[model samples]
Target: LYGAHLEGADLSGTHLEWANLSGTHLEGADLGGTHLEGADLGGAYLDGEISFAPAILRGAGARDINLEHIQCETFTEAFGDASVTLPDGYAAGEGKLSHWSPEKLDWENFYEAWRKWQAEQHPDLLPPYYTAED
Candidate 1:
């Protein structure tokens, strides 16, 4: 269904795992309980009543994509491009929003920033490199 216009379609409880719905227009579609794990939604125009939780958006294009309304929190491969707009309190290379690409870093305090970010994003997880000490 690459680039197919399925706007306002009632697709609830459907299993569309790993389907190539790249660039598809899914505005106002009833995607509740729809399984889009490992699906390719690159460059897709998505808006209105939909949830993408637990969906493996690995390597999916994030150009002009906004997840503030969806509240997605999954990470895998390349997820952001130049036009990617993430939710509040989220950066390109942070927890559940790690971008598989080089981005601007606070070179002088990269480590400290990373540590702070980890703590803020995932306080329950262990530190990087499995260090017990903070």
Candidate 2:
């Protein structure tokens, strides 16, 4: 439903996996327990109240999405990963999404900071963040 307007729609538990919701208007839509995994929400206007968990947005594309007025079910629950780029004004702290008004660093810089800290404190474990395994 890309670019569609579904204002005030009761869409709880909808299986919207991989839907192209770019530029869509979902103001006041209920998305509780909705499966939005791998969905593309780029440029979507999402000012509605949503009941979301961190896994709800796993692998979802949310670049430039407007979540300025969105109220999730809980706060500080880790949401997206490195691929899911969050918008400005919102930040992923401790794996959860919250409003952070401080200077932000890109992923590479953040990773480098972590690596530097690891190299200084724990030199033995100063290596790749994860092992290459399939």
Candidate 3:
């Protein structure tokens, strides 16, 4: 269905493998758990308006898929293989957006900030279940 208007469609968990959905208008479509392996998404409108609660493309030929319009957050939620072209400044294998990966976080700084906040908010108060440590 090339160039078809499928706006706001609830296509969750649907198997659309090897389908020619090029240039399809999928705005606000619920593609959660949808299997789109080998589907032709070239020119497909899967921008920020759509909900891709993890569409599967494990073995899809996604080299031609244009991800310029797709949001990084939404794309990260999906499962893709090496064929899928990720947006610039992103990489696979982290199970999360590359920029937001745990390795990139400053845990020490965050812990210090949290400690300061806790000391200021509750100087002498600790929850009964929370055991304080030296």
Cα RMSD, each candidate: 10.1, 9.3, 16.1
Clashes of 3: 1
- The lDDT of each candidate is 0.54, 0.51, 0.54
Mind giving the per-residue lDDT tens digits that candidate 1 earns over 1-134? 98999988878778775566768888777776676544545557777466454444433334445555655565343345324455677666566565422353332243344334435544443222435354
- Position 71, candidate 2: lDDT: 47
Clashes of each: 0, 3, 1
lDDT of 3 at 67: 59
The candidate maximizing TM-score is 1
Can you tell me which runs of candidate 2 are displaced by over 4 Å? 48-55, 72-89, 92-134
Q: Which structure is stronger by TM-score: 1 or 2?
A: 1
User: Across residues 23-60, which tens digit of lDDT does each residue of candidate 2 receive?
Assistant: 88887777777776556566677664643533364445
